[model samples]
Target chain A: MFAGLSAFPLTPLRNDEVDEVAYAGLIERLVAAGVDSITALGSTGAYPYLTTDERRRVARVALEHAGSVPVVVGVGALRTSQVIGLARDAADAGASGVLLAPMSYQPLTDDDVFGLYEDVAAAVPLPVIVYDNPGTTHFEFSDALYARIAQLPNIASIKIPGVPAEPDAARARVEQIRSAVSDRVTIGISGDASAARGLNAGCDTWYSVIGGTLPEAALAICRAARSGDAAAAMAESDRLQPLWDLFAEHGGSFRVIAAIAELGGLVTPNSLPLPVRGLDRTARDRVARVVRELGLIPPA
Target chain B: MFAGLSAFPLTPLRNDEVDEVAYAGLIERLVAAGVDSITALGSTGAYPYLTTDERRRVARVALEHAGSVPVVVGVGALRTSQVIGLARDAADAGASGVLLAPMSYQPLTDDDVFGLYEDVAAAVPLPVIVYDNPGTTHFEFSDALYARIAQLPNIASIKIPGVPAEPDAARARVEQIRSAVSDRVTIGISGDASAARGLNAGCDTWYSVIGGTLPEAALAICRAARSGDAAAAMAESDRLQPLWDLFAEHGGSFRVIAAIAELGGLVTPNSLPLPVRGLDRTARDRVARVVRELGLIPPA
Candidate 1:
């Protein structure tokens, strides 16, 4: 079960290979910041873009540096058997659990989606986190479907992405899911700008994007919200507003977050996969101003 | 460039490994049927679901038995660098060319789409086919975007999946693209039942699903259509109606085609990737009747 801020680590690359040194450094910082959990290979981590070999390596490296915190490896794929294979590998690599999304080229029936999770969960002893990211998967789970999936054994958590423009609606959706599922199941929320709203609505964990690179700030927001200190939570959310605005203006948070990590010297400046590009010069400069204003970059 | 009926061979599996013997036989049949081109690792061929090594093997096996016909290997992936790498491998494996779709998790801008094709086309020495399949990729190319992409060096063809229920609309869309691009680029249409309409509307090729397993029937339809024999073309189409109706109902043709290939004893009754399932018992019975009626199944 997860609580507080679950950091989705940004994948650091050097010379076209995953930079283990930089990646470990990022994880160590999150651990030091007392981030509740580390979800490796999340959307920000470019799980779909990596090769199977690369994914295995990333999962292994993440668990190695996670220390006491659980490392949830993203194991989503086009095939159920492939997802099962990844789950086996993740368990063998000592991952805490596997996060699965029903990803497919063809439109999948509700039964097909349920079958994918059931088969994978049955194959591995590890816990499963159902990832509902409609933006990437183009497969949305209705509340009824979510409630149904929550009944499967070993399905430990559900990460629901918050709707960007509607905080109240997003919070209400989380509460609805929360009311439907068992208390044993952990329900978390993703969407950097809306994480506080999700927390206020009683989602137990913040599956965050900016939190992957800016853990201290994310933990502060989580701590404030969890303690019912709305003013403090709003201050942290307001401080992060500039970056969130940039992410909203662009398509999503992946590129802008990577840009901030690079600018802050958290990880080496790296190229994202083709078509999902980083911020333009103007946007990068804006990101730099926000990073400086928030004191994210260490003193030279 | 491609012309006439092009076969997209199904990837057969035996104990989760690519069945080399079954695959080779499938390719040999296409060559014998005088298919103008062979497209390996297509949607029906399950390209995205396969591993990198499996995809390379599929392409090599395809080229090996393609004989006199050109073999176009699908090289699309979620990453640009990955696509370039696959294109390089396709060329190395003696493939005639590569087909690419702007596959991504992020919603790409028009400029991003153009850039992906440009970079991949620049990296390889083979002709590139721009695949515009919105059903799978969810990335639609505006006609202006298609015209721009067609202008890129080494881009030889465009595979446009037909608008199934509307032939006139599909034909008009094809004409718009045809008028926008130079004559050097060949425009082909996919969707088995609509192939006759596409050809009648000036599409140069039938990029087929049934053609992969039952090449003789697909070729007969194409031949009749190309020779201005409307009655013969319609007759062929009407005969194939049961199968085409299945494809339209299923949302995409991959599963139905895979089902037909299995029912006809084409490739040892292969397993398609998860979520892309074959027909149910009732649908399978319908497919069996169609296969028997059309004499697609070879004699024991």
Candidate 2:
């Protein structure tokens, strides 16, 4: 359950509330597509934007709908006490494991981050995934910090950001972190664009953003690598270059993924939380055209 | 009311709850010291660490105890709806203005950030202070973004981070921003170590961190600068170089300020939000030695 493709789904919203039905639909889609794991309340899920009650409900929905696929809930907060509380909630809701990001407002010291993982480890019995998404959390992890934290009990995995573009560089980077943590801790690659490259570099899992929405496409790439066909995996990823380009041009995957969900009718229009407007008409139209051209959406 | 020294007091906590009596005492002390205004939920106030209800209670306590001092509330949240809601609460509590930072979970685009201020401006009636605290919020506003936001109606002030150390460069930085906004928008400076320099460089206000706990020392530097005594202001700031050194050595002012508040009997021991630990015993003893030598604390 700790390895292979882990899909990160958006917890869609409607009228300023979590659209539980829509969110469960997202999870069921991932489960049906056969992702090895489903991570609810990921950065894609807008965990920080939600209230405690909303998070609890979202966790329960994911657990109920995910069926055999292991559910990993993101339990991150600014305060240590809050993170611990969220971790307990996740455990109570039957989460298989908890993904913990050292979410920060005060720029956290390495010690502060270590203290966070330490406290969570002491309090929660579930496996902990050390979430290292600096793009959102703004706290970069040192290999030393990863090494230190990976030694803690139940530190199940480390979700690293994108690998370097070049093949050798990506492998070396993965190996560097690999040398730091023990073999029991799986290495999962995020940064949807670099998924193929990271997998070929021997990463055990793709903690994928795109996997949540287009699981069939994501699994095509994931399965190719697992079958030892590295070239096929890269070829599959290249096929989705348009989507990766959109992610780069925009700030991140959240809005772009939301745009796709709306176009596919998987989620309602205006499904994003307030203050995050959808892509402007021109960019959105470009996405529709590209998805159709790529056969990701049926042409009219 | 947006100019001069605006003290940012910590909303002291005890046993994981807001210590309202202690919080009121901190506000009253700032009032007695005659700061130009009181910002109840600045980064110093641990605004992001608190809940909406805790923030509301703190705002009311600040208003009730501040007498006639203008109170500006920090209404920052990760989601746009949450920020606007906090702003509405601030307005309902009679805050003179609201300070807003682009609090982020997913890295925000410039457009995303602009839309946030736009939504808040349209939704809330209070004067808006554009809080540019990158150390905490992790979002940097380009000068163009600042100019763009300043054009919004009800945008009252811009709280810039700090000026360059060189006098000429500092003045140029201030002048660069001044040329963009109309005079109706005041320019406030944060970064406590640089406040005197910023004031000397003609910044209209000092949005201070240290001022929340040590008003007299901050006011000395601020008053000297306002009285056309730039040299004295520099000297006053220089006299507190030891404290500045401590701030420089530590991560930021939050822990050090918590230590000061605790040592001076303003709040209970370990009043900071959890996961954020106080300084080590050695560092704390050093702080105590410096304070006693500087007469910040009476001998004991």
Candidate whose TM-score is highest: 2
Interface RMSD for all numbered candidates: 1.5, 1.5
Error of 1 at A193 (Å): 2.4
Candidate 1: stretches off by over 4 Å: A163-172, A290-300, B163-172, B230-235, B290-300
DockQ of each: 0.68, 0.67
Give the per-residue lDDT digits (tens) of candidate 1, residues B1-300.
488888888887766678888889889988988888999998878888888889999899898888878999999898888888889999999998898988878778788899899999889999988898888898988889989999999989998877444657766877788999978999988878788878877788888887888888898889998898866887888887877777888876777777776776766664677656556889778777877777777432
Could you tell me the lDDT of residue A99 within candidate 2?
Answer: 95
- Candidate 2: tens digits of C-alpha lDDT, residues B136-242: 77788999999999999999999999999998999999999999987799999998999999999999999998888899989999999989999999998889999
Worst 10 residues of 2 chain B by lDDT: B291-300
CA RMSD (A), model 1: 2.6
Question: Candidate 2, residue A153: CA error in Å?
Answer: 1.8
Tell me which residue pairs clash in candidate 1.
none
Which residue pairs collide, candidate 2? none
- Report how far residue B115 has shifted in candidate 1, in Å: 2.6
